[model samples]
Target chain A: MLEVKNLHVTVDGQPILKGLDLSVGAGEVHAIMGPNGSGKSTLAYVLAGREGYEVTEGSILYQGRDLLDLSPEERARDGIFLAFQYPVEIPGVGTNSFLKTAVNAVRKHRGERELDAMEFMKLMREKRDLLGVNEEMLRRSLNVGFSGGEKKRTEILQMALLDPKLAVLDETDSGLDIDALKIVAEGVNALRSPDRAMVLITHYQRLLNYIVPDKVHVLAAGCIAKSGGKELAHQLEKEGYGDLAGKTGAAA
Target chain B: MASETTTGLPYADRFAAIAATLPGQSVPWLRELREDSFARFAQLGLPTPRVEQWKYTNLHPLTKAGFEPAVVNGQGRGQIKALQPLSSLLPAEEPAHRLVFVNGLFRRDLSEIGALPEGVRLDGLGEALASEAESLAPMLGRAVRSGDNALLALNTALMADGCILRIGRGVSIDAPIHLVFVGAAEETALAFHPRNLIVAERDSRAVIFESHVASNGGVYWSNPVTEVTVEDGAEIQHYKFQDESLDAFHIALTEVEIGERGRYHSFVMTSGGRLSRQEIRAVLDGKGAECRLTGGYLARGKQHVDNTTEIVHAKPHTTSKEVYKGVLDEQGRAVFQGKIIVEKDAQKSDGHQLNRTLLLSDRAEIDTKPELEIYADDVKCSHGATAGELEESALFYLRARGIDETAARRMLIEAFLGDLGEDLASATVKAALQRRVSNWLAAI
Candidate 1:
């Protein structure tokens, strides 16, 4: 469902992702793990089409189409979702209204009839129950004064509502407590199905315990150092990236 | 009466022709007041950029426009031909006492005044002056002296028609009083000065909604001065919307004085006019008095909108709060000057003021000045101002959720302005103003 071929990205004229290649098939979940400043978030932002992440070389293909050619909103409407590592605190915008607008926009782009207020509320109630998100949180301004756990849970809620074909999770578990991590993982696990792919970018293997991934790759020096099955995550978690540091010619 | 020198008077020739036809000419006190005001205005002339208060805004365009007085054009009174489409800001179904004015003239045919409460005087200033001129003598211009501001003097000298509302002691009016002032296009550019006086007696309560709108395709100037007196224990919520034509100039000033334990709150939104300035000066005169001034403005194209406010705390334990937000796009320009003063006797006074603006384009500009002068050591007074473009992260967050770019920007701007209306007491006026903001966003 997603393919990145020798992708080299730069931000502020400094190269961050150099010759990075990765591929994920439909119904597969891949975990990309790296230490601090190893270009983990850079890869996520590049896939999400964020500005300032200039692609200096190579290309990204999603479902056999050039993903880099589409704008951020176009990528979103075409079933690509990016859960921001740090969700912006937007005061004055009601979370419920924002969610409704996003849901309607995506639905319209998919050739589906827009849901009325009543229908949308019904759907929101169901999703809220599944993710343990209460009505009060949605009534307040978007992520303003929200706790770290609440923000992460809301990101999951948005993912559930949009139901994107390819979901990019950027540090979703970085600030979450154990309870919030489980809730977020449960929400993500429920959405796992055929014809849908998800990329989990994390600095720790703690999240892999809740929702196991089919593959794991260690990113170092702006490129993937090793790719293996799920067991590689446990190995890296136990031994750290000390052994891979010599190959990448950088201190871990 | 045209002077020979350049500084003779800004509008001396024009004021000379319309002085005889002004309202309240027969009353001796009113006549002297007009003459004195005209002389003061002649001395001050037009405010130049050299003046400290008028540094950011230039009145050169207004003077060069060569606008004649509307009263002399015979358009202040009688029936107007194109009055059908000019509607009140309030909904038709809402119960309101409405007074309509066209070209600064009271239009009895267009005004819809319901049955006012007992002892409440709701009528035109022209009518009030014609009958029982003594009743309005002490209250008119009591909040602000004409000698303090040149534009106030100009308005006082050539005032023709406006709304005169007087609420008796302890009277509480449930319905809002609506004042609609429309400037209709004519053969030549016209200027009109409307004088408004609102007096809420001790313990009285009322709300007033004032709207200044202009008909399409007119180069007119609407110079209005409104004075409000909130007596001891009285409460008044004064709301105004200035939406003149895109080719027009709007210069308005409102002065309010609150007595012991009185409450005065106001919100003025400006989204129209080629060049406009809305200045408000409020004073808390007695102990425990309160004042809140909040508003939002939207400007685009070559429009220039200015909001200048001053709140003075004169008595101990008085409180004042102000918040103003604006959005400017294209080559639009805006100015916000907020001054807060805590006098020596105003010990324990609490005052806070905040002004934030969003500039949507590189060419859009905003000049904000927040002045805080506190002579009392025990008072808590602070002010802040901020101007910046929209947050790119916020915009990208909204668009990442499938919302289009335009929709995202609108949502953020709406949120920026909508937060200011959360603390408003009147829901009806809040909704009306919100609708106006939405309409302005749609146009931009």
Candidate 2:
């Protein structure tokens, strides 16, 4: 469903992603594992159309359309979702109200009937029950004074509500404990379908235990160093990235 | 103090022409008060930019207009009827006791004061002076002094008519009392001076909503002064909404005195007038008293709004809080000057003040000054002021969620001032203010 060819990205004139290429088909889950300073988060941000990230040379194709030409909101309406590592804390906007606005906006862009207050409440209740999110958390300001676990759950709740076709999880298990990691993985696994795809970006292989991926790709420097099956994660965990970095340099 | 009479001498002649026909001119005490105030105003003239209090505000609008006294009888009820369908300006669901004044003169035909409770009186100042002068002798001009400022002196000198509200001891009025002042000038530019006096006896409770609105596109000046006295253990909430014409000018002064254990809360919302200033001076005279001064102003398209306030803690164990916010767009300019003073013997006094401004355009300007003067070692006082554009991260977060740029900006601005709006006691008034905020946002 998505293809990236020789993606070159720069931030403030400093090159971060250099000639990176990747492709994923429909209904497939890809896990991009790398050490620190790898361009895993940058790829997610670039796909979601964040500002200040200059695309020096590359082309990103999403469902046969150029994704880089769209704005952030347009990309959101086009079914591209990025679950941020650090959810922003908005002081005055209630979480429920924000979710409603976003849901309606996406629905309107897709030429669908907008959900009213009653219908929206019913949908939110079903999602809350499935994700085990508290009702009081939705009543409070968005992510303001929320715990790390709560924030991750809120992001998962939003994902369930929006029901995007392509979801990019950026370090979704960074600050989560074991229990929270299990909950988040369960939430992600429940949304798996034949037409949906996910890109899980992580530094460690701990999350791969709960939500197993079909393909595992090791990202070193900026490009994809190696691609293998799920057994590759166990090998990477047993042996550090020191040997892989050298082999990847020779292969590139 | 440069007392040179170059640009302000014309107002002296204008005041002289209307002195003979003003209300309460026959009373010797009132006559002497007007004469003294006129002399003071002549000496001070209009406060120039050199005056410390008027440094950020320019009075050239008032001086250049050369306004004359508003004709009381020239505009009839038909004109007021034409200005009707005022559902947008009034409260939504609650039944309010309304006192309507046109051009600073009490319009009996347009006012509706539905049967008030016993021991409560709400009427015009002219009527109260003619019948109950003895009871009002000690209250009038007591909270506000003549020599405090130039505008107060001018208001005292040419004061015509305004509303007077009095509540007896131990009585509580449930419904809000609304005082509406509508300004409609004729071919000649008119200026009106309105003086309002409110006295709540010991242990009494009441709420007052004061609105200044203009009906036509005429250029006029509405200079109003209000004096409030909250007796021991009494409570009062005052809301002032100013929405005048774009070509009009407004200058208002409010003086309040809170007794022992009394509570006073005030909120001022401004979104009108070419040039306007609302100055408030409150003093906590008795121990354990509390006062809250909060306001928000939205200025756009060359409009200017200023809010200057001073709160004095003269007794021990008193507390005061102040928060003022402003949003300026286009060439609009705003000023906020807030000062808190803790006297030498006022031990254990606590005060906090904050002023925040949001500049929406490159040319918009805001001048904020928050001052704290503490003479008591046991007092706690803190003040802060900030001015900046909207936060970039917050804006991006909203936009990334599919909200457009304009809707995101409006939501952020509303959230910035949401706390102050939620502080109001009446849901109806809060809803009205929210609607006004939305309207102001839509206009810009």
Candidate 3:
């Protein structure tokens, strides 16, 4: 469902992702582990079509089409989602209204009927209970004064609502505690289907235990150093990315 | 202070030609007041950039245009029909005691006044001047003086017609009094000065809404002055929406005085006019007096909007708060100057002021100045000013949720302005202002 061939990217005239390659099929979950400043977040932003992430060379193909040709919003309408590392706190924007606008936008793009206020509220209540996001939290400003756990839980709720084809989770478990992490994992596990693909980018192997991945790849200096089964996550956790960083000229 | 540029004022001939026909012409005191105001205006002339208070605004547009005095002949109902959309701020179903003015002349045919509560005076200024001249003599130019602003002096000199609202002692008016001023200049460029006087007697309460709009897309100038007095323990709520034509110029001044334990609250929204300025001066006079001022402005194209305010804490335990936000795009420019003052004897006074602006284009500009002068050692006072563009991260967040670029920009802009109206106590006024914001966004 997604393919990256020798993708090279730069930000503000500085190269970040160099000759990175990856492939993921339908219903497959891949975990990309890397040390700090190894282009893990860079790859996620590139796939989401954020501005200023210049593609100096190579290309990205999603469902046999050039993904770089579409805008950030177009990519979102095409079922590509990116959970930001640091969720933006937008004041004066109600969480419920923002979610409804986003859901209706994507629905209209897909030729599906838009949900009315009552229908949207019903859907929101179900998801809100599942993710433990209370009513007051949704009524307040989007992400404004929200705790770290609440922010992560809201992101998962968005993912469940959008139901995108390819989801990119960037450091979703970084600020979450074990209890919050379990709720997020349960939400993601419930959304898993044969037609959806997910790429979980993490700095540790902790999240792999909750939602096991079909494959694990260690990224070093913007390139995949090794590719293996789920056992590789445990191996890397026991030892660290010290050997991979040394071999690829990336500092640990 | 007169320079070569201040010598020639076209209004000298117009004021001379119409002094005999102005309101309250028969009264000697009113006539003397007009003459003295005109003389002071002639001495001060049009404000030049050399003056510190007028440094950011330029009156060259007024000098270049040959704007004649607007005449009230009562001949343009069709033109007013075309302006129905922009003139009314209240909902259609809402029962409002409204008074309409065209070219600064009160239009009795277009106004609707139900049975006002006893002791409440609501009518045209011209009518009041003709009958109750003695009662309005003390308030006509009491709060605002000719030396404070040259344009205000000019307004008093050539004052034609406006609203006169007075609430008696201990009376509370339930319905809001809506004032609509529509500028419909035909062939010749016209200029009108409207003077509005509002008085809330001891322990009285009232809310007043003003809408200044243009009926035709033509060159005109609307210079208005509003004077308000909140007596001991009285309360007054004032709101204004200025959406003049893009080819027009608007300059307005509002002066208010609050007595012991009295409260004054005002909110203004500006979105049109080629060059405009809204100046407000609020004085907290007695102990426990309070004042609150809030506004939102939007400027696009080559529009220039200015909001200048001064709040004075003159008595012990007086309080004041102010917040103003603006948005500028294209080559638009905006200016915000706020000054807060606590007198030497006004101990325990509390005052705060804030001004913020958002620039949407590289060419858009903003000049913000905040000043605080506290003489009392025990007072609490603070002020802040900021000018910045929209956050790129916030924009991306909205777009990444499948909202288009235009929709994303609209969402962020709405959010930026929506933050200003959260504390407004009037739901109808809040919704009206929000609709104006949405309309401005859609037009841009």
Ranking by TM-score: 1, 3, 2
lDDT of 3 by residue, B1-444 (tens): 132345345656556557887777788898888888888787788888887878898888898787777853322222465336664366756677889998888888888988889999898997787677898988787777437578888888888788999899999998889898888877778888888999999999998888888777888889999999999999999988888889999999999999999999999999879999999999899999999999999999999999999898999999998999989999999999999989998999999888989999999999888988888999999888888988999888888889898988888889989877876778888998888888889965
Question: B250-333 in candidate 2: lDDT tens per residue?
Answer: 999999999999999999999889999999999998999999998999999999999999999999999999999989999999
Comparing 1 with 2 on lDDT, the higher-scoring candidate is 1
Residue B349's lDDT in candidate 2: 95
Candidate 3 Cα deviation (angstroms), residue B295: 0.3
Q: For residue B174, what is the lDDT in candidate 3? A: 88
lDDT against the true structure, each candidate: 0.88, 0.86, 0.88
Q: Quote fnat for model 1.
A: 0.88
**Cα shift from native, residue B268, model 3 (Å):** 0.3
For residues B1-444, write the lDDT of model 1, one tens digit per residue: 443133334456666567877777788898888989887877787788888888888877887676777776344532365555544266766788888898898888888898888979888897777677798889887998436588898889888888899999999998999998888867677888899999999999998988888766688888999999999999999888888889999999999999999999999888889999999999999999999999889999999998998999999999999999999999999999999999999999999999999999999999999999999999888888899999999999998999998999999999989877888888887888788878878865
Candidate 3 segments exceeding 4 Å error: A250-252, B1-8, B72-83
Model 3 per-residue lDDT at B69: 78
Q: Over 4 Å off in model 2, which ranges? A: A242-252, B1-10, B72-79, B129-135
What local lDDT score does residue A134 receive in model 3, on the 0 to 100 scale?
95
The model with the greater TM-score, 2 or 3, is 3
Q: Global CA lDDT of candidate 3, please?
A: 0.88
DockQ, computed on Cα atoms, for candidate 3 = 0.82
Any runs in candidate 1 off by more than 4 Å, and if so which? Answer: A250-252, B1-11, B73-79, B86-88
